[model samples]
Target: MPSNTDISKLKELYESLDRLKESGEDVVAEIRKEINNIELQYLKENLFPEMMKTLSRKISWLRCSVDMNLQFNGEKQLDYSFCKSGSTVFIRDKYECNCPNEDILEESEMDSNNLEIITSTSNQTDAHDTPKRSKTYTLRVEFPNGKVFQGNVVSDTYVAVIKEINPEKVDSVGLSHAGVAVVSQTLDSKYAKYQKPIGGGWYVMTNSSTKAKGFDLKTISDELELELKISLVPLNNSEEAIPIMGISESERHRIRVTFLDGRTICPMKVLEALVEVVKYAGVDRVRELGINCCADNLILKNPAPRYKKLCKPVGNGWLCNTCSDTITKFNQITEISQKLNLGIKVELV
Candidate 1:
């Protein structure tokens, strides 16, 4: 049942066991320790979803058709081996299960408090194991329909599949960005029938195949290639920002707050409302504003009447389109956050 990555580690562990035995070490005890070490590592990170699936065992069951392969070199990829098998997979299912398993592990309050909300992936690769540079990069993709997607990339080779959203597929996803082309429609597509905003949708990008860091995605297709040229935009609300077409005001700039105490607030507030959050809810108690939980407030940065640096008929008494005067606004926010000792982040969805 081991994956390729797991088999590799198991082989290394066997070699270590042999070496330890030859050195007059207690082979049985030493191997036990070695196996325990491996278990500890897997406990730290489950590259496979086995544990997660098991936790949801009573919810629903599915299976994965896995293909295993090994190759020594590219030139002689002919020198390869492979195996295929069917595996029963238990994953989270949409059908609400009122039956709760006492043994089911839920994220603890402590864990929720420490949970990171905003995580960025990168797409750069280094072949020679060069020293890693602490480089942070932002990714922005603006659709011709005035829809903008923004995020940070922390990995050099993190690739996202750019799929043109289809209306027929719209009734099949909860995230609004799912039901992609490269992937098969999920079982929950039926659940999407109840979703609102029926019609043509924006082109969306979701995680795709990854081979190496710094891989050229253009090789995939013309559509995939164009995704790499996404323009960068300021994350904070800008004075002259263009409203992303199709997305609602509540959907675009709204803030969703989640606290460490297992509480959540989906108040449709906005840009300056972050200050009040810190004032009311102290700094450390606020777990997150954007990631995981619903956003805390709505900046209403999009759905502009017309795209402009200082667009007309601006709401909130200001243009939400320009990149101008960001420093001052950020300063004001920073001052408020610092004064209240809050570690709040203002994110635009």
Candidate 2:
């Protein structure tokens, strides 16, 4: 999950470090430190969360199923099963009294057979029930250049809306949620909540009803023609903003920034535009402007210790606080452009 680029960079670093070690260079320590950083980033970004999700799903399946015969440690054929006590699950012998046992088995104690049973059972259940849960919804895809495609899409419990839009292009594009580009492989139900059975099937994709911001299609593949702003309207009627297509006016309007070099970035949110501006006019230059970068609970640069949790790197060793309202983000961009003397025009289209 560390991406091909990360893997290539790590391989190069390791080879360089080995050569440096043979040459008796002190730079070996720096390369080793960088390798450690990449490993830590992989664990943080991919490994840990994936492990947790897998564990959680297994536990949930076990809790829902009745009388699971799982062997512990591969030595004892214990007729153990899980029982729910409020929110916590406790293990108990299948033949024993209905009381929950105090002792709980760790994941390490469960043998490969036990894990296999759980995984297979979960998959079987999903495969069996998916067809019954399938429903049709209105799919309206609007591109950055103002091209729109309106159609109907049938979705199962597992299939995402992006996949339903264009199965071949799903890998090339992703949907945006909370200003973050959510992978196309993620379950649609995870982001868009099913409101009712209106207009074939209605689902809302906005901050109020859902975490979905809009379609964040990327031109990562040659098959994808357009790269800029794309919006997927989930409703049959665009004017009525309830039950389906519940995006606010701000979420609907795309922010466009024109730089001095005749390069322009349009159909992005305020925060995204601000991040691009910072990337264009380096972090050091923005700080030198002596303008207050902090807005709402966000500290754009030079964040205090308390705000560190809310900050993410925005190039050049600078952190941008992500905790801010939409309106505050717009104001901050305006202030940043005015103070930097960049004469960059920020417009909402």
Candidate that scores best on TM-score: 2
If scored against the real structure, what TM-score would every candidate get? 0.19, 0.29
Q: What tens-digit string does per-residue lDDT give for candidate 2 at 1-349?
A: 4555665577688789867887655758789888999867766865577667996777775533222223233233434443322322334453433333222112222322265676687666554465454222343344555655444442221134344344334322323334322332222544445321212232322332221223232222112544333333344443432222233343344457898888998743355676787777777776666544333223354654333434567786776664454344445566678877788877644
RMSD per prediction, one decimal?
23.4, 18.7
Residue runs of model 1 more than 4 Å from their true location after superposition: 1-133, 145-147, 153-164, 167-182, 187-228, 231-349
Instruction: Judge candidate 1 against the unseen true structure and give its global Cα lDDT, from 0 to 1.
Output: 0.34
Q: Residue 340 in model 1: shift from native, Å?
A: 76
User: For candidate 1, lDDT tens digit of each residue in 133-250?
Assistant: 5433344444446765455451211223233334233222212222222222332343333222222342222333222111212222222223333432334434233322232232
Point to the candidate with the largest lDDT.
2
Counting only residues 3 or more apart in sequence or on different chains, how many pairs clash (N, Cα, C under 3 Å) in candidate 1? Answer: 35
